[model samples]
Target chain A: MNEIKIFSPATVANVACGFDVLGFCLDSVGDHMVIRKVEKKGIHISHIEGFDLPYETELNVAGVSALAMYNTLDLDFGFEIEIYKKIKPGSGIGSSAASAVGSVFGMNELLGRPFNKTQLTAFAIQGEALASKCEHADNLAPALFGGFTLVKSISPLKILDLPSPDGLYATIIHPQIEIKTSESRAILPTEVPLNKAIEQWANLGSLVHALHTNDFELIGDALNDVIIEPYRSQLIPEFKLVKEAALQAGALGVGISGSGPSIFSLSQGLDTANTVKEAIASVYKNTEIVFEIHVSKINTQGVKILK
Target chain B: MNEIKIFSPATVANVACGFDVLGFCLDSVGDHMVIRKVEKKGIHISHIEGFDLPYETELNVAGVSALAMYNTLDLDFGFEIEIYKKIKPGSGIGSSAASAVGSVFGMNELLGRPFNKTQLTAFAIQGEALASKCEHADNLAPALFGGFTLVKSISPLKILDLPSPDGLYATIIHPQIEIKTSESRAILPTEVPLNKAIEQWANLGSLVHALHTNDFELIGDALNDVIIEPYRSQLIPEFKLVKEAALQAGALGVGISGSGPSIFSLSQGLDTANTVKEAIASVYKNTEIVFEIHVSKINTQGVKILK
Candidate 1:
């Protein structure tokens, strides 16, 4: 296939207890990208919709990712990319990851599927690094491979796609306020207390176990972020009240998605998910900030070719 | 039904990547306790073997654990306990946990199985606290519940028993050196760098996922302990050499068991386990320190009534 269109799902990184290592894909919000083989041997961004992202090959995430794949494969052919962004940038829901993953994934298919998921993720990570200044696969891994993904090591690039429990729903509320990922990251403590670190690992281990065993209650109990959320949550307006409301409305656990402004909660059913959404909305009803709420089951199909 | 004899298996706390939170039970090396009903309204230690343990009800781990159970139940009858210790104290395995768990577990059975595993773990933690000055269930949880266990929280105690993959072998080498648990713990940094902590959680999250999915290679890659091993491994003699040798000889991963002096390696089969045992022994062959090696599968039945 000389031309291909791919859709990559939004991802929730950090996943409450698992900071910098855990992430899962969402079904509803994502980015769409189309890549077509060009006669010229250079990458180009032809068009961008919904957001004013960089169109230069080196500046655009999708363009850079496709370029990385092109260079990695030593392809003589060039590709032009067209991006339609549905997931808002700075939404803390892996908007950048969608573009990065979609580009490499689409390019891989255009290049006759020359790269595996891990190799594709490597190129995607290079693209993502342009935005974050550091390479992290927590968001991109899930967006590329689907389900819950754990970035075990970045140097060796170990990514594990974890089992997503049945009946799990993600309730995401994008507060429409942009929180710079860098600023949100800057608020985190450079050094965490040893006791708190222990608690954090315990919670992370328990959360993984819950996913493996499909224990919803254990997942709820383990969805605690003592280290990051305690500091970062202060930046988001009404974070505590919304979280409290979500819990009262039967959310298993709730926390800031990726970096904040967007809060995600895990629930077992649609009813509880809708309830959590309404509860979060009620907190922002009086506020002037426009919010977008999306309730979705986990995106088991991560990045896929649309054409 | 007036008297019962129980055996609680030794446990490997910390489990490499999961510091202060993860542990697994072993088939061999444990403490045995025999408890009998008496007319007196107090707990007593009638006999001790293999070590010079305190005979007082409040000072001894077995005594304190029995007392905790007795107080929790407000039983009308007293009990006398006889201890036979097989796991050497200060060996870095769960020697103290064996006593604490065996005592409470035996008492519970004597009292017609009044407390469940979690409740029994609670009593056991209280008993262990008498020795450690703090309550931690990393050792006690696995000792009480068997297999791999994660203590998610201590306040509202949440423990998860992970599934043990078939054919998994544990090769433990206990060098005849003593490292005080308190001193070992005291040497750890009061705070950890956020980057290292992030790597640690990633390894831990990956390890749990590996266990759930039975991914041996992933488990091998993720069995890294950057936070504790770098600091505590210094307390154990020939730690680096032994670990390297074990890894070269086909061990999945190797690290100091619990606090130190005992180093454990995970292998997929008995052949590799025996090879790892020889590799560890070859490292310490010229040294003056005596060492004991035991290779066994995971103990599924943690504490059992031996009748």
Candidate 2:
């Protein structure tokens, strides 16, 4: 392992109705890390490109994941990592997930890829726990494997691969606003209403079915979130207006991405995809939260080593 | 238009965790109905065969469904009908569904097949209301379209086709004891614990994924009913012993069939299936009820018209 160049993708956590249990990978919006083996027994970091992200080992999410992977495995080799943070921090997308997944995925290659994708997810989750306290595998699985994925059983962390529906396009609008993950989660009640939870599950079951059979209409109908979204939507300014506009513009379904101010809508074609973006942007008159519109397919590959 | 012969198969409702939303058709065990235009203005019912079924039109489920279909559509066709009941009444396996589907389906042919499958399901549900009070489509959809099916957004009754999983076999043991459907339903609470419902939904989501991907192991893992089964199992005399024995015999999961006096266990293969059947039978040493075992595949077709 002389010079290792690894790429880790961005992830979307708290995926709509799935909350802690479901998510898929996004290929275009992600971060990359290039790590080179060094002679020293300690780690070194550099910010090569993209955003001027934190490079301190303790401050950086990628650095934390990389350090944890090395320490937990008892590896003696030190690494110098260069991160290209394409995903903006606090975007409600798993911005840190790219760092966490990229670091652990890159570190595994440096250690001769001892851990498989599922095992690597655990390492990435360890780093995520540092920030969220709860270890979520929803974002990590998609960040690792891409496509539509379900964390069916979590005790042993059983990962079920879901089919990526054909002719499906995701239109994400990142409204440049600051809503911390903690604050968004804080608005949600510790305990949810019983009837609301059942409806959530029913919708979830239908969603899983729609993904499996690639039924776009069914997928649209099943993307409802009753448990967290109702309470959490209040934290995001213009959430309802944005959602209505996006849907009226031909988005099949729209909801908060992860725990957000960032919102995403599912569309069948690029035309509707573009319409969804413009519709969301029209509502944000107060702040220039730098809304980025992404129209892409489900990324079926999680973490990849570039070189 | 001439002599019309159509088959609507029997279905399994409340499929473990799916309760109201999930059901599938059984190919072998169902009602057989045949309808021919008699050139009259009234439906003349005759030739009722198989099982212990009544010849009276008012008491017959199939006759009721046919009457509803004829009245709702205002079809002016006099029909001669033959009914053969295979799925026994009070067996917990959607017995009334077989008759209800058969009646509407057979009459539709007699009326020149005016309705589509979903439309037919709507008419059949009207017949089911006579028996169950509430309108449920889970049994009717699968009974019409063979294979695993989902009744989603059930108020409007949206039917979805689910993939039939591989390596799945059912070991069903019917203890010849009488338990009325109304009596069984009376024992269940109108409401359930919130957490238990979530667990049920989680299992249901996993079950849908399992069917989509043909994951038999996961199907077994997901065949749990946290709410209805626990309370209803008390009604079945040998529920625990049969379940324990079936699991011991390598069956993946076991639960009450429909409203039970009947117990069914799901297994991976023929060897395990036979063992499961024998295990359930052994527990009824002193009981007067004779146990019958069925080792069968999931019936895709709901009802049939055997000449």
Q: On residues B1-307, what C-alpha lDDT tens digit does candidate 1 reach at each position?
A: 8899888899999898899888999987888889899999899999999998899989999888888878866668899999999999888888889999988888788777778899889889888998778898889999999989988888898788888777788999999987877789788999999888888888888888888888899889989999999999989988999999999999999888888789999999989999999988999997998999999888877989885
Best by lDDT: 1
For each candidate in turn, the TM-score is 0.96, 0.90
Q: Tell me the lDDT of candidate 2.
A: 0.76
B96-152 per-residue lDDT for model 2 (tens digits): 887788777777665566888888888888778777777887777888876777777
Q: RMSD, each candidate, Å?
A: 1.8, 3.1
Clash count of each predicted structure: 0, 18
Native-to-model Cα distance after best TM-score fit, residue B296 in candidate 2, in Å: 1.6
Worst 10 residues of 1 chain B by lDDT: B68-77
lDDT of 2 by residue, A1-307 (tens): 5777766766666566676677877767777778878877756786557777666887776777777777766556688888877888778778778778887787677778898888887777776766566777777788887887777656787777778876677778787778876787667665555446556776888889888777788888888887778888898878899899988998888878888877888888777788887887888755655666777666777677674
Q: List the residue pairs that clash in candidate 1.
A: none
lDDT of 1 by residue, A1-307 (tens): 7888878899999888898889999988888888899888988899999999888889988877777878765657788888999998888899888999998888778767778999999999988988778898889999988999888888888888888998899999989887776788788889999888888888888888888888999989889998899999988999999999999999999988988789999999989999999999999998998999999998887988775
